[model samples]
Target chain A: MEDPKSLSNEESLRIITQMIQTAKGNLKGSSFYFLLWGWVGTLGNLGHFLLIQFSDIEYPSAIWLITVPAWIISLLYGYRQSAKEKVRTYSDTLIAWLWMGFSVCAVILIFSGRFNELIPATILMIAGLATFMTGLILKYKPLVYGGSSFWIFSAMALHVEPVYGLLISAVAIVVGYLIPGYILRSTI
Target chain B: MIPDFKDLDPLLHSQLRLAIMSLLISVQSAEFVFIKEKTGATAGNLSVQIDKLMNAEYIEVTKSFKGKKPVTTCKITKKGIKAFEDYVNTLQGYIKK
Candidate 1:
């Protein structure tokens, strides 16, 4: 709108309504890292499982190293997103720190030297918590339900064979990450 | 025009400043570009009005770098919110009449 010396009350009210709506609309265009993390997570787990089950790769688990770059990408993406956003909501800050904590926890568990099913179980549990919290913050039902399903998959991971643990992770990532991710993408 | 509406905050009486304040009040803080985009104001024009609001202590302006690009963001202050609320209340009174 052009700058005007004087405006009627109705004109002033209209401008306020329009601008507030434009600000609110800006919050809806983000589903970037959800899709990123989901794809990387699902593919990484599947790759790990296939090598362990069908091939004699000396270190099938080494496939997880592929995610190392995803971490860098995630960080850089988050940094860029932060820079690009003109507004900062409370939920934005909370969700960013929440995933950050989840990343730290995952990193610690991966390096904890506990080569057992419990590692996957605990990791899934932590992942579930982060997903659930993010869903709550965003008020998205698909993610909320998907996050809840992670708990079920985590339990199943405990009873499966060690090689199947990789498969279970793949499934958990699919249900808990990819499904909600697709829905979020569609909504955006 | 009416006597009742005349009591509205003069700082927020103009269209662009009111729009800027409305946007800032909706979100915690907003950048200069975002404000300009939302309000449909020219950069120079928006900057002058923003400076008016800033000088009145109605909003806070922060200048920082988004990567190599310079960015300016603004947030409505407590005084600004009170003024906006008062303006709306006065307008409501005028309308109800």
Candidate 2:
């Protein structure tokens, strides 16, 4: 094994070059995660709007109003994090808060019967799958596998039992949001 | 016998140059601003270090326009990469207990 510290000028230069290349790879990996989550959040918001418009259920637009801001905040935070500062730690914290807030809102929606619409269910499943795939492509274990579980559960919930929707939502938030958020916080 | 550390080329072995090289190695390519930000070096210092690397043919620098902004990108040469690996291996011999 080569000694890094005592490298000659020529040798040290080579190592430095490798370090830069690795940093770039890391940046790409992290950026993919940020974009994937951002898209998931946006799709979730859109799903809510569609549910309100199509379903006869008496759901207030107020929940969407609240959730929209969270998604927006998360999206902006993700963008800022990708912009070269590597604010992964701060963005991860923000994502956790956003998801926790989302989870609470989802629970309330489910209990209120607002989430009974097929549109919301479909949206959740699609968003989950997309996130899962994004994670897989980047080999981001937290996102790839976690997102896959979220989507797989959502898909199953749609067919097997509707009540499982709530559980699926919870899993989505926990894995897709909370866990990755915390990991990003600690690792990045 | 291995060359003395002090005898190493100052252009390639300087602290700033080493930092720049390390960062370059990790990324596909990095911009001047990115390097400056990561290395915490002033523009003048980074420019000088980059110049040294370029002179030594250890790194390649390209200038381009990103939208309205002019961007400078740098990449490490294959020779530079091998040299770094060897240097690290050699250094380990001295430091390992």
Candidate 3:
């Protein structure tokens, strides 16, 4: 290998740029996680709403049981991808921790079983912050916009009926997760 | 145009070492295998350079067992971060000139 001193100024700059690009490429796999959650949440929200509207089921919230399988799949998928990831960047660690914190809060809220009509909005608000922070770190605009959409929809959800809140939740997922997820994928 | 080269740190002036530093700057810590794959350097060569950086106190290395196999992880020290930042600033100065 050539010593760094031997390289011209331009060559040095080139190496720095190349390495940064490579680091970013490593983050592309994260799109799968976003897409997975986005699609799953979308289905869950819509399914719950439809069931509540037309079905005579005693516990319409039971439709959310689908999240059990979704969570299992996400964990397995995340673990497999994690094992394959050789490099762990600073932003990567931060983003992971952010989501982990969100998950903890979410579980606690779900267990608390309070504010049934407000849960969806609360989740969206949290999701907005996470998505927005990620966008700022990565300097990706689409995600920032997506995150903003979540905040907007979350407010709208508060004004709507419980059944309608599900629809708002679904729209937020599509905007916040699915759009950016696909954009991140294409950049890879 | 000629770039000002006086401010460049000699320790970070080697191609392999520079690559290693660049990688370390972006992440909190990375495994030996990860650095090896990214830098495309052989284990012996990479180990030597890693040791050099460690001796300089620019990075810290930890050796632990993951299950039955040993894992070596490298992290940039505070000194390393300062050095990398200085090098980058110097580079930018040169580029600007």
Candidate 4:
């Protein structure tokens, strides 16, 4: 590292390539967020299904309240991650912004309160896009497939009754979110 | 033709400084400790090289407190990216010759 005056072009090229590779390879996947959302989404869907089918609940949709705690947990996890993450790679920044955009869009759709029947499809489509781009950036195939699975489920969800759609949504979270989330967690 | 070492950017010609620029260019930003670990440079040496880059406007260095602990982060500036690209193109010219 001292006085590389005698260093050859090949040596400089080697150093640049080696260091760039090191930086690119240093980023680990944020699997916790994915898994957390995956479980929460799955439960939210299944809870609605169970509450509606098994018990004569006054409001089955109220089961979606589970996301309240999930949001707090996600925030705490992100705070802890930012505290320890030494390198903020472009991929990380891009992914963070992508999800933030997704969240904003999702919130806008829900608050519009017009597409109540289309809510499940809308969520799946946005989730699919985010997951797909994330996989593309990270070059991870399982997540790429996971993202595609959401679209497939989205199509199926559209054709079913809202009650049946809940079950389909649960299965989608399992295949499209939870499975890939676990794979990402294990790989890291 | 033999390679013209004189044509190379002297700032980026050295081993450690070039390595630092190379690493910084690849990421959005990196912590001082992370750069040190990656470059395998000592803290004192790393600080000196970082200062040189900062003074040259080749990189931006920021210092802030993370709770009670101090943190330093480095990011390659636009000039740094341009210089690095030009250096690579120049090196490639020598190789192609």
Best-to-worst order by TM-score is 4, 3, 1, 2
Give one digit per residue, the lDDT tens place, for model 3 in A1-188. Answer: 33435877787777777765655635576788888889988998999899889999998888778889888987898787766666677788788888899888888777788877788889888989988988887788888899889999999999989789999999999999998899889888
Q: Against the true structure, whose TM-score is highest?
A: 4
Global CA lDDT computed for model 4? 0.88
Give DockQ: model 2. 0.20
Residue pairs with clashing backbones, model 4: none
State fnat for each of the candidate structures. Answer: 0.80, 0.30, 0.56, 0.80
Model 1 bad stretches (over 4 Å): A1-15, A25-30, A55-59, A159-162, A186-188, B1-7, B65-68, B85-97
- Candidate 3: list runs displaced more than 4 Å: A1-17, B1-8, B64-70, B86-97
TM-score of predicted model 3? 0.83
For residues A123-188, write the lDDT of model 2, one tens digit per residue: 566556655655554457887766676666667657754434544554565667567655765775
DockQ values, each candidate: 0.58, 0.20, 0.47, 0.68
| lDDT for each candidate structure | 0.81, 0.59, 0.84, 0.88
Question: How does chain A of candidate 2 score by TM-score against the true chain A?
Answer: 0.52
What is every candidate's alpha-carbon RMSD to the true fold? Answer: 3.9, 10.0, 3.9, 2.2
State in Å the error of residue A154, model 4.
0.2
Candidate 4 structure quality by residue, lDDT tens digits, A1-188: 34536778999999999999999943264688788999999999999889989999898878888888988998888888889888899988898899999989988997899988688777988899999998888888888999999999988998988778889989999998899888888877
True contacts kept of 3: 0.56
Q: For candidate 1, list the clashing residue pairs, or say none.
A: none
Say which candidate scores most in lDDT. 4
TM, every model: 0.79, 0.50, 0.83, 0.95
Better of 1 and 3 by TM-score: 3
Which candidate, 1 or 2, has the higher TM-score? 1
